[model samples]
Target: MASNPPAPEAPYAPVQPPTDTFGYGGYRTDEGPWEEWNPTAESIRPVRGKHRVAKQRGGGFARSSTVLGVGVIAAVSAGGMASANTGKAPVSISMPDLPGVGSLISDDKPAPEAASALASFGSEAAVAVDADADADQSVADAGEALRSRIMAQAESQKTQVEVKAAAAAAKAKADAVVKAEKEAEAKAAAAKKKAAEEAAAKVEAARLAELAKQYTLPTSSYTITSTFGQAGSLWSSGYHTGLDFAAPTGTLIKAVHSGTVTEAGWAGAYGYRTILTLDDGTELWFCHQSSISVSVGQKVATGDVIGRVGATGNVTGAHLHLEVHANGNAEGIDPAAWLRSKGLNP
Candidate 1:
């Protein structure tokens, strides 16, 4: 111990390791009479190694959900492609039930075994992709069937509507045609009725003109002194039943129409009266005449001289009293209305 020189005194302090660029944990350096103590295994716990939480490319659960969504999209896209390529109808494709990848992630513990399970799921996903084409064909078939049914229903409805519209149009057209026909018939009937009336009027006018040519006035330069049905004491019956035409005593009288002389010369009260009988059994009496020009049974034409006007028996002045009896009726009708029936104004 004397051979070695004494060393410098050192302060009592904890030992510290040398500094280095490489970071290292410190080591223990103690020299003392200390006994090594081993704590109870139950009291002390084993320290676990420090570990880092590995984040997925996105969040773990979110990335898992994204993968599942991508798979579904791929399946649908494959179905569309199958429908386009194959002429055959497609059948429905049911997706296989899959375990959830998000449930495998944990906040506290790392899941190394879950990664292996995920690798197995990846294999299963590959199998699903391989079978996707067939599944797409089935789904396309089902869609095609549904579309065909809907199209058929629509086409049927359209056809029904068209038929109804056409029927209605036809009915309306028929009704219009019938109405037009009826209207035309009615118009034609009206026109025919008007034409017949015009023709009848024209025929009547011609007949009247011919009758006027045949008929003649009883006397010229004479005036109507009295009409039929006059009440007076001068008449023997107390009522005049004849038309009286006044004139000078020698005025000439003529036959009104073609007729036969039934009686001529003096009839006591009528005074040189002439009786003319027409073809229709109408008797015309010219009373108070000065002279008679026609004999009994003599056929006289219309306008032939029959008598002369004079004041004779049963007369107040120079006048011709004319009476008419038709159809053996002794009582005479009004001469004015009777003359109008033959188209005469007198």
Candidate 2:
């Protein structure tokens, strides 16, 4: 772009001052004449690019340029006066004092004193802000620490509870195992004892069966008229002392076991009697016989005919009275029980 040349300086020309309405000149006092001036484009032109503001340093309003620094100080002074009028504390601002600038703002205080007061006020504000920041940081740190401590304590308590629960569960399981083992042992012992008892009973039954083949009844086809220990007035003793087998007269009587005939003779109440003594000294007595077949001291076998059934010598009927005396005792035992001991039913 082409630049235009600067306009020449206008000539100094003078004009008469104007009157209000009647062409009368305005009154002039002091020792000077009234002069007239007319504004032109060149006289009222705005200056450009002549004064440049220096860049500010350290974010402060103070500047190296005297013209710019004076404007900033004037604005701060106006703002302070406005705050004071509004009943609020005046804001303090720090700035470098420009030479001859303080005379334009405040004539009462020197520029250095005003600059010092502003710097002191700014320092105090900075200190207060730093203190507040430090206090907030401390509060934040304390809160974080407390939260961490609370979390740790809660975690520890939870861990302890979990451990205790696990321990209790383990103990219950162990106790259950012990109880089950004890119950199993008891069942096994009971089964063993039952098996042993059954075996013993089987052995006893087999022994009794073998003894059945060795013994026999004394007589056949005969009815038992009376048993041992029968209470009656027909006998001399208070109770019947023998087992009576009733049959027709002359019915043969057999020996109960292998024994020697100890005696065969007529007694007071026994018509014909025979006594058999075994090797073990167990005596068998046969009374009320019609005839005696075995002689005295005769070794007779089991099932041999020893006497005959007869009703004689205080007998109620034809019957054979049999008695058993162990070890040759005079008192006889129950003949039926003695026969059962030898594995005979009667």
Candidate 2, position 53, lDDT: 53
Cα RMSD, each candidate: 18.4, 16.9
Prediction 1 TM-score vs. true: 0.45
In order of appearance, the predictions have TM-scores of 0.45, 0.49
Candidate 2 whole-model C-alpha lDDT, 0 to 1: 0.74
Candidate 2 residues lying further than 4 Å off, grouped into runs, are: 1-198, 232-235
lDDT of each: 0.73, 0.74
CA shift of 201, model 2, Å: 4.2
- Pick out the ten consecutive residues of candidate 1 with the lowest summed lDDT: 31-40
Instruction: Give candidate 1 misplaced runs (Cα > 4 Å).
Output: 1-188, 229-239
Residue 272, model 2: Cα distance from true site in angstroms: 2.7
